[model samples]
Target: MVAYRSKVVERIELPARERRERALEEAGYNVFELPSEDVYIDLLTDSGTGAMSDAQWAALMRGDESYAGSRSFDELESAVAEVMGFSRVVPTHQGRGAENVLYGALLSDGDVVPNNTHFDTTRAHVANQGADPVDCPVAGARDPTADGEFKGNFSLERAREVVDDVGAERVPLVIQTITNNSAAGQPVSVENTRQVREFADRIDATFVIDACRFAENAAFVRRREDEFADYAIDEIAREQLRHADAVVMSGKKDGLANAGGFVATDDADLFERCKQRAILYEGFPTYGGMSGRDVAAMAVGLREAVEEGYVTDRLEEIQAFADLLEDAGVPVYTPPGGHAVYLDAGAALPHLDAADFPGQALVCELYREGGVRGVELGSFAFPDTDRPELVRLAVPRRTYHGEHFEHVADTAAAVLEKRESVSGLEVVSEPANPELRHFTAALAPLSD
Candidate 1:
């Protein structure tokens, strides 16, 4: 079928190449690309739940009584203990920092770190360390339900298969978490988490919780299962801790605090081993590289994040965004789970295939028409270089007001209208094994 551009266009040739990109920008149009915008409506990820109160921020800035051997460490430790109910906790700069220590210390070059799907950074750390980061394709990994709700649920059988395929001695940690980021915020139910617990016990594999999206998981628990629905946030958090040896938190998202994270566990021996990593990457074990105030803030933030209204508010906004797109006839990730919406760019623009940079093209178009930004997921976030990419839009916790929904909806619909005429994408070569792969956005030029 012949493609067509939006009817509301007036094309003008520009002498300078920069002018061409500038023209799109000057129009105040955009779909936020990663690393570019503050108000990016992102569903692509989350630490867990994010953005602590100003009080928490102030506390973090106050600096705990301990810098290295400070009381801050004790305060922070106590806070970590309160959340996970584990006395043994080590602080890291952030989530990946925690991963570095975990993999650097525990995993040898030949070891395997298995999970449902490791985040981009986690995968990089494992691969860079010369260990195979195995994402045991959950049973339903290949075929996700339309809504993508079940994507986070890993098959115990798949875990078994991977373990059997690669002996347990070679597998260091079985770690994965809530709102499996790569899977459209699909949640792994408590039952599945428990199953993992039993499996870990059977295999003697160390189970690590990437509680990055723990709050969302908790929300799901309350929504999906009745028994959990009534449980208080802190109570539910404590119970979830039963299944894992330790947790790596990204305070940015989960703790609701600013820059700090923790590697925590109740296992005394493993806890001591984890401390060494602190000395190397983080500061002294006492402070674990974070100020006591951050500890205090996170401690307080963690509790506040669990407030019923807060989680509910975030969920409502996400649904509202989803509703906006759905009403516009957009092919959104059905049954949108958490913050942000996944517009099936391939389906939305059948004229442009996902293989030809559908996500990147769509994102560029949105930016050219509306000043909203989002990331690519199926088209970019997904694994398998030769697979569909996702243009992931991550909506931060409480990032938008009601008016913003209209901006997102109208902008998306306008782009979808020009779907047929939008240019397809081609990878102009990316660096091999680079940490951040850069892609230049281009539309197949209007040819003769």
Candidate 2:
């Protein structure tokens, strides 16, 4: 494959390794608490951190700043229809904004929403609306090293059980998160999505897709699914969307934009309801919570993200980085998910218990040793859950080249070399609110 060349016009000088360690320790061993200037390779998330293309920058300058009936909105709507096959689009500031609008409009007290696996914000929104979020992921998904091609798939039997237990009337929505984030960024197969749509039809529940990484998921489908082997990535994406009643997107992820999101559907009634809620919480339907410039940039990004060359290259880079860690004897999720590589902190640091926050320990150590920052997706993120303790290194799209990934791998290797010296962390200052505590929670090194 031909190399795609882009110029790097900026650089940051990282502080010495010891100074970085001291900074982390002073910040209560929290990577999030550290300043960006002190870090080198920041992998906290792929959301809204990708490098925009020259075309996207050009689109930003063409933005229509009209409060309503903006030309930017029209471009965004047309782009959604062209790429995602959704006729009606409601823009928002980001993915969580899109979730807030959709769930707030659809969910009521005593309602139940079933998904393969809900990400943190998705689950939080459901709970905030007085609704319960349940997971129906396939059994294999629990294992970090599971080789199942569609490990992110929703279990049909489990979905049936949920519907039966709660009664179909009580279940308003069934969601399938394409390239499931919580399940180690695994992709849900096209066949499984069709099955979920069928299940939704039988239960009289609306089928929705959490499509933050839909392009990546569609690329995986083209590669892995036999029926879709000959299909183009965009075609597979459209086919996947055709199986859903609605889609909630975070444009920050797959859209390649800095920040924007939307809730889209063919159902006119659902569109109206979501639009009303969007105006209430977000901005007007035309602009949602985003500015006209953001809308224009997002429109360009939506088209750029699904290009075959770009998606293929992105996944390959992610897999190569994961392979590096795995080769160095680090425990990683096999066959890596679409956007990021997840390290099994529980397995890697078995000496420390979950209560000690082994994942958080590894995260902090990476920052200290190599100025590489990553986020903990384990006990720290979901305290009461029985999920595996994972540390995610989310690679930003088209931001860094091969060398940067290699540097990250080397950093992980350096941390692994002194694994025994790494100590777990204990929470020192937690927020009064239980919702999304990981973002603001403070911790300190546990006494040996």
Each prediction's TM-score versus the true structure: 0.84, 0.98
Backbone clashes, each candidate: 39, 1
lDDT of 1 by residue, 153-239 (tens): 766776777788889888767877666776666677777778888887788778888887677677777777677878876667778
Candidate lDDT (C-alpha), each? 0.66, 0.90
TM-score for candidate 2: 0.98
lDDT against true structure, model 2: 0.90
lDDT of 2 by residue, 38-95 (tens): 9899899999998998889999999988999999999999999999999999999999
Worst 10 residues of 1 by lDDT: 1-10
The Cα error of candidate 1 at residue 346, in Å, is 2.4
Clashing pairs in 2: 283-288
